[model samples]
Target: MRTSYKNITGLGSAHKGVGHFIKQRVSAIALLILVPLFLFQFLASFTTGYSGVMAWLGSPFGAAVTFLIVSAMVVHMRLGLQIAIEDYFGGAIRTVALLLNSFIALMLWLIALYALIKISFGG
Candidate 1:
């Protein structure tokens, strides 16, 4: 059997929306784990200078973690912005918001991927 709950707009079940929230929360937790590591790395970069920083990033393990952290960040941003758009914007604004979100997400992914590769491949 199936049941439905009326949203404020009274259109469909609310359960569909829960995954969005869950995904966002998962990303948030991931970020919480990454933030300290990222900050510490950034601080170390300053201490060690460019060559040292690049050397650290150039490591296989460093490259892998960087890729994972950046990818998760982009996914997190998408979910958050999607929720905001759907919550407040309507009609054309919502469409525009979605387009912008997609663009930003892709940009982040590309930049992060490039950085990860450069770090992994030695330059």
Candidate 2:
């Protein structure tokens, strides 16, 4: 039996790469569907005035779908960035990049959620 350097050094595959791959694929598919739906809704609302747009966003279905799209988008963005950083970076630089990636994603998510909530509540 032969042991590769990776195995010997306990640096073999993370055993979770497949999970990240699967998540990225799933998120991509989700975005594919959600983006069209969102665009349709958004463009449709443009013909309406501010009150009408607010009304549309306040609807339960609209709120839910918007939330879904935002959440999926943030997740997809984060996962993609994480993969790119991991592939192109190393050591402390990698750590900082990943952390910054996550922070940016988190901030975007929070901002999105805040807007969604405000719209949904007519605030």
CA-lDDT, candidates in order? 0.81, 0.86
TM-score of each: 0.78, 0.80
lDDT of 2 by residue, 1-123 (tens): 898766666545764435777888898999899999989998898789897778778888788778889889999999999988999999999999999999999999899889879887667
- Please give the lDDT score at residue 91 for candidate 1: 97
Best by TM-score: 2
Q: What does candidate 1's lDDT look like per residue over 9-88, in tens digits?
A: 44456546567777888989999988788777768776888887787788776666677788789989898889889999
Clashes of 2: 0
Provide the lowest-lDDT 10-residue window in model 1: 2-11
lDDT of 2: 0.86
Q: Which stretches of candidate 1 lie over 4 Å from their true place?
A: 1-17
Task: Please count the clashing residue pairs in each candidate, in the order shown.
Answer: 0, 0
Q: What TM-score does structure 1 among the candidates reach?
A: 0.78
